[model samples]
Target: MKLTREEITAALVGLLGADSVIVEPVRMDPYLREPRKRFHQPAAAIALPHDVPALQALARWANEHRVPLIPQGGNTGLVGGQVPLGENEVVVSLVRLDKVRALNAEAGHMTLEAGVVLETAQSLAADAGALFPLYLASQGSARIGGVLSSNAGGVQVLAYGNARELCLGVEAVLADGRLYQGLGSLRKDNTGYDLKDLLIGAEGTLGFITAATLKLFPMPQGHETALCSVNSPEAALALFYDMRRRAAGTLTAFEIIPAFGLDIQLRHRMLDRDPTAGPSPWYCLLEISRPAGGPEGTLMAALEAAFESGGVDDAVIAESLEERARMWAFREQMSECQSREGASIKHDVSVPIAAVPELIARGSEAAVNLLPGIRPCPFGHMGDGNIHFNFSQPVDADPKAFMAGAEPIHAAIYEIVVGLGGSVSAEHGIGQLKTGLLASVKDPVALQMMAAIKAALDPHGILNPGKLLPPSP
Candidate 1:
């Protein structure tokens, strides 16, 4: 039998102390609202456990009562996975678990509790003369657990991999309150099944991550930053090919942007100044990390070759550290600047690296055909083929109307993405936002296997119900 909201609160208070439970609505608002503001389900209560054992007890109680629990970190997730799905659920904030359990710079790994903020982890690695490569805009607010849960990919994913690649192992609380002590710092441990990978991107539908052993890298001497003006996405793709050919491993970031994005930023006064070479419809921001003893100007030498070959029309290399920051600010501020315009439709999708040009060209044309004057601002990690395909509303159009017609616009763009062999959701996981879309596009057998795994791990379905996976038949 299901329990009432009062019963759920009573049971949780019985397991943990009454002081640990938060039933009042106003105080629970922050934990309920996600970064996207797309999901608005009210949770029955907000549970804050001070330690691992307390968290385990709450999970066990939640499981016995078949009550859903949404595990959250710093609550910076783009998707709605970190927030509650329905009134029956409870949001379990892990902020109290913040602690650096162990750090081994020589071993190139560190064990951190789930609630350790991503920026803090980076600081820890830097203090130890090492580097943690998972950099994101929300790093200041996003915690390790949510980062690994989403398998977030920032601009540097071109050099270092996503959160899953950066993470070695995780210590989590499984359904029914059993602790999963799978944290390992070994280079290679081929033990039975790789539970770490499964849990990393499961988006909390699988288990509640408590701590993690994350992989670190040797600090680079510096970086070579440049803003290249390409005629179009085709030219940008060609430039990326040349950069990859010359600077194979050191090529860390290759981002693409449109002049419209810069215009919006400048109009909104988001950037100090324009960072591009001049006025062009498109630009490619490329960078390469110079090793401790490696020669500098490697990127400069390659850019010279591309310019000679007519692949790049114009380019500006950063002459100082401040200049490099300015160039990156132009790229990083793309998403926020869009909000200055109006309600924008957003899609984070990825295609084959080679098909990126076709994806952008075809997608932009289709969106325009659907909604004339729909400002297309498709930009992101070009090297990895993930484009944050977004569209600002037509000038003076009602925001509500624009959002109401977003579904057809989404269909048009997604049709092109699927035709070119692209993923519907990349970097961002399938939260409540994309459950229907995932069910439509994913393979039937793969879906079944996922359901089986989820059922096996969480037979009670008390872990983040109605989030990543679709409802069982």
Candidate 2:
């Protein structure tokens, strides 16, 4: 026997009070709509649990009834993970759980509630004379819970690391409503199977991340930012090696961008002025953080060496904070600028650091061959090997038609990426969008292990029902 929609709604209202549960269709729009505007299925209700106990009660009931629950934070996830996949599902928004539970700037750790905004966490760290380096374009709205759940990697991953590395522990509600109190500031804990790591990147399939203990760092005194022109990806790679040799640990960020990226940004009025030194085939936006007593001119000296080696053709080092911001603006605006051109197909993939040039070259050629005049805008964390391989539709092509024919293009790109010993997904987790893709690319034994873990933690299949894992055969 199953509960009807009205029964589900009334039960939720009873458990969490009428104010916390939303059953009206119009009022559910904000929680229902995801960033990509894909996956538009109606939810039975939107559950806004006011605290940890309320959330636990809701999860307990959902599990017992075998009702699916989708854990959402900020609704900024690019994939449809935060949105409902079926009408019977309930979206459990964690927005009201926002809080700063504890902060120890000197100890290099802070415990933050899942709903705390990423930007707010950064500010809290900065105010305490520390820095939270996990930055993203959507940081303003992307909450800590989803950030960790997705295991997000931002620009500075070259030095600091991704969300998984920055996090020390997590506090989550299991599928059966049992709280996993794993929060801590410990740098070493060899007790067991590392449950914190599992929940951090689990995509809410096993548990709901209610809060986390995140690692922080001492604020850098300043940053040396530059946008350098390179003849090719190979040249950029060589320069990257040289920069690493020179700066080593101080090298915080090294991003790559194509000329197509700049042209579109300027054409679409996304930037007030061009941020590059001059016209070039490609560009590398590199930055070095200076410590309290660190030497200056590190970036300039590295570039001079790169210029002598012909790895860098031209460069512009930021003489002021404004110039530095413009350089970063050029890098951060890469994804949004592509939309102005028209419909675009995007892949978040990664290869070995040394294989990135080959990945770009082969990927671009394959895309052009498939669709003539299709502009390839392959750019992103070049230092970390994750290239946001995006292709803008052919000029004057129908957006609908171009999008309809995306399967062949995706197949072409993924084939090349896998052939080069790369991953199909790098930073973005296997949300609803990539579950099938994950099944195809992932190792058979690995999939079995994941299934076993899911079965153990969520036997009723109530937690994020249709996400991360592919359908059972």
Candidate 3:
């Protein structure tokens, strides 16, 4: 009952037109290339279904043939979930299905196809006089379906929530080609099982997402942005608490940046000019979203309070839109700036807000002890307790030699993170990058339950095979 490559291509051409099927390896290269370049296996063929019905048909045929299919969108996922794992798999690109089904700004919702780009979705909401509010550096290329599938969390997750919370409902095609039409703009629904939630973050193993109903919010009048100078991580934590008590929900983003970030930016000339208040051991980029008819200067007043109370050394509030953009630029370019420094080890982990200070302090000591003079750039989403704890390669050291010692560095930091009850992956999911770490860190009982669910949903192991769930012990 096995289908050869020729037969699989013939069946795909039968369901969809010949133009929709790609069998040549050279032509299918773009679909296989992911952002990370970590996964490089070639797919059997790349299938581009032009419509939802065709996609469902292909999925059903693939399921019956025991052929693996990887659902891909803009191909912008940092994790390798959007690319193929083996030559036996095929990638189904969702680009052609991009469309806006409906938009109701007053009702605060919109229905969109899975293939719509995140930036385009933001533009659509802006045109309707509302805000989608899920902003990421990859928004220009990241698709709605991939965003929801990964349950991505961006900077503003401190206020709004992640992609899962923003999605109201999803319509997906199951493994057997049955359409699960669950799209709606309902604010409250006491539904059974919460199937929509299950499929949102399933990474296409359970089903192929076709469309979704997403939540929107009223446009903020403006934002109060500031760059603060702190002597240490403990001071940054105290400043965050002061800002939270003062602004509450309006305190949308509180990101930490180390002094090395600015050094790299300056050395690489990544910024047009200096954006910080001055020099300090640490910097915190704080933001407050001002609602309609709300008072301004709340962020400035809170910074002044922190300054007087010795929580912050100095601060620079953005006086113009250009300055605000520059401050954000410094924070957003932290990851890219590290690449310029040479080889680096990165971990996106989160602990309790109260434990963040300890996580940073203990983690820094461990990495420093393991490798002397290893620059630690521990920053990001301090309000969410998610720090992108990355270590820059030691100065004047060989990149290969530095990377070879990454294991001990990772082990040391993860030990501190686990001891503090933190998650190894704060935003990025368990793609091919973190499968080994997941096996070691995840609860045994939870892993068993996940295996059972994966077995039931993908009985043939054809959908995104060898992902998320580790192999049974």
Candidate 4:
């Protein structure tokens, strides 16, 4: 026989004090509310362990009782990964574990506790005269543990790589309460299978990430940002290739935005002023980092070459830090601005950087074919080809009615993505949001391997019971 909610709460409170275990529904409200608001099921209780030992104790207690425990950090994930899946589960929040365990800028890495906010981690590196280089829109509230658990990829991924690459090592508590102490700052270790990679993007299905050793880069002397106007996705792609060829690894970000995105942001007053050079069919926000003692005008020279070659229609280079912020604000506020317009369906998908134009063209065309007058807002990391393919409600359409018609649009988009060798869930992990989609599109052999590994690590299925992996075939 299994324990009831009351019994589970009592057991958790026994491991952690009553102050740490929140059984009341009202007090658990904050942890329950996810950013996307898609998954609404309530968790039985919220467990806020004070440190690693307390968390291990709580996990051990829950594992023995077969009580599902959902590990959460920051609670800022777009997919339903960080939220409760069912009423029987308990959310183990690492928010109280915020700490900077170690910082060694000279050695090019830092050890941070899971609860340290993403922005705080960046600031810590900046204080040490280094750069963390994992720039995310939700970094202000997204914590280290959740970021690593999700294996987040943000704007600077073109050069710095994703959360998985940026993370050198991790410390996690397994489903059965054993801690995996893999936090080593070494660059090369060919001893055995990479357990850190397994846990980084596991979405709490196998273990709860308690801390991480993150790779850092030398702080750039300055940044050169530009918003270039392009006539079409093809032109944007050409420009991206040109920029990459010219700037190479120095090219930090290459984000593409549609006119629809610009319209929504301006309408919502999300930006103080327009950041683009002028109106066009599309815009590319490309940036380059200036290394210490490096010559200026590398980005400008590249842009000049693009203009000469007719790859860019027009461009506005950020002359000041304020201009740079506004330019990035226009890019970062893409998702929030869509919400202001009304109901929008979002897909965090990716294709090859070269195939981006085809993906956007076919995806948008399919979406339009399915629903006449559907507004497509295909924007985001063009350098890495991860577009947040989103669709806004038709003019004057009811939000509920529009959302009701999301299935066909999703099907059209995913079919094209898979056909073109693109990913259905690019930056966002296969949380509850895309488990069904993952099953349909992911390779059967890959799924089998995932299930086998999951079974090996979390035989009890007590950690994030219904997330990431799908039901076995």
Pick the lDDT winner: 2
RMSD of each: 1.0, 0.8, 1.3, 0.9
lDDT ranking, best first? 2, 4, 1, 3
Task: Report lDDT (CA) for all predictions.
Answer: 0.91, 0.93, 0.89, 0.91
| Residue pairs with backbone overlap in model 2 | none
TM-score computed on alpha carbons, candidate 2: 0.99
Error of 1 at 440 (Å): 0.3
- Better TM-score candidate (1, 3): 1
TM-score of each: 0.98, 0.99, 0.97, 0.99
For each of the candidates, give the backbone clash count.
0, 0, 0, 0
Candidate 2, residue 183: Cα displacement in angstroms equals 0.5
Per residue, candidate 1 scores C-alpha lDDT tens digits across 24-53 of 999999899887788777989999898999
lDDT for residue 278 in candidate 3, whole number 0-100: 91
**What TM-score does candidate 4 reach?**
0.99
lDDT of 3 by residue, 386-437 (tens): 9999999989989889999999999998889999999998887877777788
lDDT tens digits by residue: candidate 2, 336-419: 889889999999999999999999999999999999999999999999999999999999999999999999889999999999
Please give the distance, in angstroms, between residue 98's alpha carbon in candidate 4 and its true position after superposition.
1.4
Model 3 residue 424 lDDT score:
90
